[model samples]
Target chain A: MLSVLLASGVANGLLYGLVALGVVVLAKAANAFNFSQGDVMALGGFVSYAVIVTMGYGSVAALPIVVIVALFVGVLSYLLLRPLMDAQHAVALLTATIGLSFLVKGTIRLIWGRQGDYFAVPPLVSGPPIILFDGAVIIPLQHLVMSGGAVLMLALFALFFRFTRLGLFMRSVADNPRAARIVGIPTELVLCSAMVLSLVVSAVAGFLLAPATLIFPDMGFSLFLKGFAAAIIGGMMSLPGAVIGGVLLGVTEVLVSGYISSTAQELSAFVLIFVALIFFPRGLFGGRSSRSV
Target chain B: MKLFSQIVGVMLMTTALAVPAFAQDVQGVSDTSIKIGTFGPITGANYAFGRLTMNGLETLFADVNAAGGVNGRTLELVRVDDQCDPAGAIAAVRKLIFDDQVFAIIGGSCSNGVMAAKEDIEQSGIPFVNFAAASNNISAPEIENIFTSMLTSNLESALQAQYLSDLGVKRVAVVAQHDAWGSDRHKTLLPALAEKGIEVAVDEELSMEANDATAQVLRVQGSGAEAVVLLSYPKPASIFLRDAARLGFTSSFIGTSVIPDPVAFDEQVAVPGATDNFVTISPSRYALDSAEAAEWLEKLTTKFPDDEPHTYNLYGITAGQLTVAALEQAGADLTQASFIAALEATSGLETTFAPGPLNCETHQCLQAAAWIKRTPEGKTEVVGLSTLD
Candidate 1:
């Protein structure tokens, strides 16, 4: 029973980790949180559903459309809010992103509100549940796919940051926008690229997690809240810390639910946030920064 | 002297002509149309309850208009989105009454939202005919102006408890949402279960938007219950069933009126053979594909080209039929008071979609329900019917 619980926790954790990873990347590069990450993820899932189910295309065929649409939205938002990003007005940027979340949410509601309550995207691969330990633990194949997808995306992100020039430009701008600008780096382009990459990460997470969670218009807010918590726990600027934090949060939630009660699981996020704030002001991985939103 | 006499005569004739028009001055009634307002969650997760039902109402209105309308007046529907929240419902009801000035309202898709707006409806004295929403408090204790054609929670709870007793289930587990929607049914279900001498093995809460039900499933499985009553909307209910299947927890899963569309629910669960032992209550007697419903299905599909036939539509259709009946009974000279009087006098009004006869004498009109079961092969069956005693 414990093993099954842990497996389920980790599976859910990976999805959260992906969302947190996007948040961290955007916060690092653009120096502003992308509050609409969850909604963007939902849009990705809906687009996949449209391509795969509605248009009679395979999952692979939907990927390019998802990436293109996400990239367009990301770049468009950055361009529109370029002045705020340049001014480094953190509060204004935060409010703008929150408004963007609403815009995306409302657009989704308008397009798909009448279709149905929940939509099920077929799994990437179809197979029976994988049983282990003398049939004591059962893991759904889709959950395994989601975990593997999350890991693969994380590795790719790491490689891109380490081996790509565009990645270095983003990192340099994140470190010191004025210095990078003086040193001939196109800070504006770097910020836009960071936004695109962040949204792409979220879109991939959406496609991978849609089968397990199902697709609904209001599905994003809860996930956004969870991802925000995971991001905060892992140290807001640390990519690896986000992954660890998400897994830890997921495991703790499951353990609390299993041993105590389900109600406790809902409250566990708040409790974890409160404890983290009191004990570790900088989080487990966050660096010292006087700046706050 | 001749000029003064002519002016006085003209004034007297004009006053006489204006008296009749003044006598017929009602807020939402005009010489050629009657305005009716409907409110529900049009833009949220519960859009089906609001939007689909509204479509059914519109279809019924369209048919009536095509057939020359009722008493030579076309029915115009004014829709307001309540988003299934109490404050939103209250504001919607007020807007319908004050701003829209609708003669009668035929809506209430969410239990809590409807209950929240009940006070405002009572104060306004507008004729309110609830299409969906099964909370007993919405209609019981009889608000003179409000009448529900939907089966109230009390009657459904009794029928559910009776079903369990007939199955000889001694122990039962309940997984319910804690919101107003779930609380209305859960409160009534507990007493009904106690009456049947069934012990509650476990009681758990699942949120409406919950994507996972692992903890609840595990706790319910550990309780050794013979059956489980799932007092939740379709989303959380399906998630619970899916998690239960994943955990190999086998039990008779029972559902309330909220899950009327068993076929869609089975698909939503996305697990093969997961709903083999699942049974849900429906206010509609006939299944969506049954011969009796073919006419409605055709009518609905024709009216809303994008929508598939659903039981929620039937709920609105039934309420629309009831409203039309009341309007016809109220006669050509219609007012809010007359409509309420007509609704109160409604007895044995059969809509063909509801399980049995409906009456508004007690304000809680619906008393019968049907059970829908999904076979392992994914076929939905209207297995049985029950009328609460």
Candidate 2:
């Protein structure tokens, strides 16, 4: 029973981690949290459902379609918010993203709200659970795919940020925007690129997670809250810290529901956030610097 | 002298026309049409419940109109979207009553939404035949001019308890969502269980959008429960059953009309032999796609080409049928009082989708519930029908 709980906790942790990665990326590059990140995830899930289920495109075909849609959304958001990003403070920019979130959520409702309570995506693989420990621990194949896919995507993101030219440019922009601007870095382009990168990451998370969780317009807000909590707990600016925090939060939530009470499960995140804010302040792995990667 | 004669003729003609209008002074009632209004969530997450139910009502109205109308007056429906919220339901009901001046109303998809607007409905004195919304409070206080065609939550909960008792199953556990809909039923279920001399071994709460139920399931299993009552929607219920199956824990899983379609439930579970011990109570005897509902499905599809028929649609169809029956019984002089009297007098009326006779002798119109099970071959079969005590 303990092993099963741990496995389930880790599986959900991976999903939270993926969402936190998007939050961390945007927070680092733009110095503003994208309140609309969850809505972007929702839109991605709905688009994938449309392509794969409604449009009769195969699963493999859904990948490129999802990418194209994500790119368009990312670019459009960047263009629309460019003026606000240039003229407004971080708080105002964050507020504008909240508006954008509502707009996107409403638009999705108008187009696909009638689909039903939820749209299901067939798992990447289908079969019975793989039993371990003399049938004590059982994990679904879809869960394994979700956890593994999340890890692979995170690893690739880490590599892109560390070694690539654009990655270094984004890092430099995060470190000191004024300095990067003086050194001939196209700061606006870097910001736009970050927005696109965040959205793309959100789309990937939505697609991978939709199989385990059903796709719906309202699915975004709760997920965004969880991911945000994960980011905050892991030190909102630290990518690796975000991942670690997400896993820790997820495991804690599952265990709370498993051992304590389900009502406590819902309250656990808020409690964790409260305690982390009061004690750690910088979070588990958060550094002394305000900006981190 | 000629002008005086002309004036007299005009006055006489006016008086003649006014007399007949006074004789039949009901709002929304013309010589050729009777207007009824419906309110539900037509454009939000709960759109399926509202829009599809309206589609069913519209199809019935069309059929009634096509069959030479009801009492020589065509049935017309005015629809308003409540968005499945209490404030929205109240405003929509008020608008339908005052602005639209509908003679009657036949809609309410969400329980809390309907209950929130119940005061307005009762005070308006407009005859209402609720199509959906299963909270017992909607009709419990016995409000005049208000009747519900859907089975009440208390009745369904009582029946679920009765089913467990009949099977001789002891040590029952309940896993329920804490949302309004689930809570309403859960509150009623405890008393019903006690009436049968049973005590719940364990009780757990789940969220409507929960992705995992391993914790809840493990706790229930550890409590030595032989049966589990699941008061949940399809998603959470499916997850709980799947997890239970994974742990090799098989117990009799009982559900209510929330999971009307066993076949869909099985698919959502996505585990072989997971739902073998599952049983659910449905207000209707047949699934929307079943042979018994072919005619309803045809009418629904023809009326709404883009929308598909669902079990929620069946609720609307039954409500529509009940409304038409009441209107027909009210005769050509269709006043609100006459309609209420006719509805109260309704009993043992057969409907296409309802499991048994729709009885409105009480404020609760529908009392019968059907037990449905999915066989190993993935076929849904009606096990038995019971009228709630």
Candidate 3:
């Protein structure tokens, strides 16, 4: 039971964690929530489909095109906010991102059209399953890959933040933008870099999910909600917190669907989010939060 | 003076002949062309059905027109977009009748939407040939002008139950969404299963919007059932298979009508070993191997490239057959009453529609559905026709 639960949890948790990274990349470094994050993820999948399916590039071979689209989306997002950033403190920036979300989703609908595309992904190297107890439950190679992908992404993200100059500049901008600007650090470029990183990470998440779940336009909404729940549960500012939050959320959904009922699966996370907000507003790990007053 | 008298005499004769000429009900005559209105969701999630249905209907109309149309007049189709919504459907009916002044209505894509429009459609004294709506409500005794061209869920489940019986399965499990649609299917299907002496070991419910059906599957697995009957649409059906595979549960899986669709079959096969055990209930004619269906498919594919030769595609063609037959029966005048008379006159008429055409009475479609078969490479095929319990 444990193995089966974990295996199922891993496939879903990995994608959720990867998406949560988008939140961390933007919120932690730039103190912005690109409300269009989910829509952008969907757009990436559609763009990938357009390249791979419509253009007849093999699904795996379409990676270069995916990266190009991701970069373009990043630049487009920057342009979307460049005007808003001039004023800076208005909640209207978030609202504009919401508008951007609709525009992107609608544009994708117009360009890709609304039909389910069954992508032909390469077969995962499946191996003989290892039995936990009864032959009823066995672990497969794909489960391991999913778990490994999540752990590797989490570790790599941590390392990137710890060891890189661009990462350092992003943190400096997030921490003290005025000081960084006075010190002659190019804060705008740092912010732009943060947005691009977020976009690339989200695009990767989209690609990862497409192989498992057929790409649908409305797919990102539920995923986006779960990712946000993980971000909050982990402490909005902590990357590790987001990963734990995501895995916990995925497992919680499965468990609730298993033990209580599947109907209550969606309601579980929202209820958890509400309870967490009431009790621990700073999340389990996030200590002190600084907001621009 | 003689020439002037002759001219005046011809003019008087012409006026006398032209005056009071509109008499004798003129066979089934309208002012100009025979106007038939159609309702379908042209721009919503179900737009594919609507678009393809219209395409098929137009192809038939084109062919009819090429043959000098029914009794010297062309068929003019006034199309309306219902967006697959009930209210939208009601408005569509109102517009088709009150605004467009159509002679008859045909080919609505959804069941519930068409059911909601039943009252106004019947009240308007217009004949409605329902192209795709399959709920029993449309074909029940009360609605007069409505004629169903698609098979109902009840018919589908009975067909599936009988198919499983033929597979020698003695016990089955059901995982259905906790909703009216699922419950209606369960109600219709369980009796058929009981008749086959197949005990239902587990009956489970999952919400329509639920993404995971692992817990539901575990319950079914624990019940020790031999075969699993999935009462679901394609989305939840695919999700259930994925969750089941991940949990490493292996059981023969049977699906609802919408579940084992060719497009959906490809998606479900991605669910790790789901292809091996997957089976579904579909009409026999949609089966690629149906030798009798060959010529029909040849014509359908030539006309509609995107639309596979599915049961619904047959329904569109059947609608065309009925429409043309009705127009012909309506005679030279082509009145609405004559069209309804033509529809009522429908019997065990044979056509390329798979079934020996449709018998208007008992509303029992002669073409019973078929057994589920899986291709070696995970593509699905509808097996040969079997008895429906």
Candidate 4:
């Protein structure tokens, strides 16, 4: 049971963390929650699916093309997000993201029509499900894929921020865009890069999620809400916090639904979020950072 | 005041004439245009159900109209997006029946949304054939004006317990949504379980909007149960299955129709990882080998090319087919009474009807009808099908 739970949690958490990363990138870089982050995730999954199925690209061959497509989509989404960034309350940004979410979901409807697609996909992660504790539960090879991708993404993100000049400039802008601008930083470019990175993360999350959940236009709305909840529980601005929140949330949900009422599942999550807000307003592992710096 | 009086007078005249052709039956809705109306959500959380529902309705209408119309009157459908809200449902019904002057109505995606507006539907006086909304309360005690095209959730849960018992699974954990509908399932299922000498190890409730089911998974896993029964919608159902794996809950999972969406199998049902020991019940099955089913599917898909033919897609098409059969029995130059009588006279008529006692004496869906589906090899295969005896 332990092995299976950890395996599933790691995979589920990693996908969620990727979504949270998108939220973190936007929130940290531009102080906004891309409400459409969920739809973007759904869009990434479907786009790759189309590339593989309709365009006849093998899933392995589709990877590079998917990345390029994801980047282009990220740029387009960034351009869309630009106007909303300047709004005073940030609610404008939220609404715009929501609108984009709706639009993308609607567009998916137009494309897929109304039926559930039953597609056959190959095993991305190799090896058998590792069973532990007298074979009580088993962990599948996909867990490795999920774990490796999550750790790799986080490492890449950290490395990019730690040493690269572009990363440093972006960090300065995120920490204080006005100050960075005063120091001759190109704020627009920084924001654009944030959008690009956010979308890339979102696309990978979508690709990972598609294998188990399959592709549906409406799937994004739920993913968006979950990602949003994870971001909120993780302080809405911290990458590590978002990662922790995603895993914590994924694990909590499993325990709750297994033991308690499924109806009370969301109720309990809200209770946890509410309690966290009251006690540790900055979330677990949070520190105060000021854009005014 | 005079204008209001005039409007009332006009309505009265329209009603009177419309009823018996005394003066109000304005349009000749014949072979070129037989108008029907539907209400569904164009916005909100459950909006996808409505959108897909609309697609099915439109496709079926086109199919019916193409096959030489119903009694020589072409089928025409008018739609109003209700956004799946109660207040919105009421307004959509009013607009369709009162304003659009449709002959009949079939528009339900959510039970709560429809149940809230039942009185408004009763008041409408138009024949209402529901394509969705699976609550017995919708048709209980025989409203006469309204009828459903699917099985109620109560029977659905009982059937789940019965099927599990048949499979020799004794101990089970039931996870359900925490709403009136989900609660209704819990209330119905426990008694059904007890009667069958089966014990519920863990009975849990989760919210429809939840993203994970960790706590719920732990309780079910800790309950020492072999199988887990889920009475949930799609969103939580997906989270539950995925999270169940993450929590090391290796118990077999059996879910309601809400989660057996075939597309999810192709998308994220993560079969080998997420779907081992998982099986679910769909409303009915269309085995590729079942001649009637294959013919029906072919006709339906061809007729309504725009709709994705899911389980519910079949429901709408079946009901439409039943109505068509009833209308045919009504003969040309039919009236409302003749149409009702034709439907009442059905004995063993199996025109897209699932296996159930078609007493026709009671307008209720007698017994439950469903088939079990499993993603054994990345395909949603109907392993077995039966109607409750």
Say what the interface RMSD of candidate 3 is: 3.7
Q: What lDDT score goes with residue B289 in model 2?
A: 62
Candidate number of the best TM-score: 2
Per-residue lDDT of B377 in model 4: 56
lDDT of 3 at A195: 78
For model 1 the interface RMSD, in Å, equals 2.4
How is the predicted docking of candidate 3 categorized under the CAPRI scheme?
incorrect
Q: Please write out the lDDT profile of model 2 over residues B41-92, one tens digit for every residue.
A: 9987888879988998999899999999999999999999999999999889
* Candidate 4 local lDDT, A1-293, one digit each (tens): 45555665666777777788788887778887776677778777777677776677766765666568668877887888788777484887778877877777787767764334323334455454666677786766666676776778778888988998878888898788889999998888888888888877877777766644445566677776667677778878777888887877766655454444445555655776788778878876567645773
lDDT of 1 at A212: 67
Q: Write the per-residue lDDT of candidate 3 for residues A120-148, one digit (tens) a residue.
A: 33323344546855666665555566566
CAPRI verdict (incorrect, acceptable, medium, high) for model 1:
acceptable
**A-chain TM-score per prediction?**
0.92, 0.93, 0.86, 0.87
Task: Assess the local accuracy of residue B260 in candidate 3 as a C-alpha lDDT between 0 and 100.
Answer: 33
Each prediction's TM-score versus the true structure: 0.87, 0.90, 0.83, 0.78
Tens-digit lDDT string for candidate 3 (B240-307) = 77657655678988876564364356454465466567777654345544576566667667877776
For every prediction, compared with the true complex, DockQ reads 0.39, 0.44, 0.22, 0.22
Q: Candidate 2's residue-wise lDDT over A236-277, tens digit each? A: 988898888888888888899889887688888889888987
**Which pairs of residues collide in candidate 1?**
none
Highest DockQ against the true fold, candidate: 2
TM-score of 3: 0.83
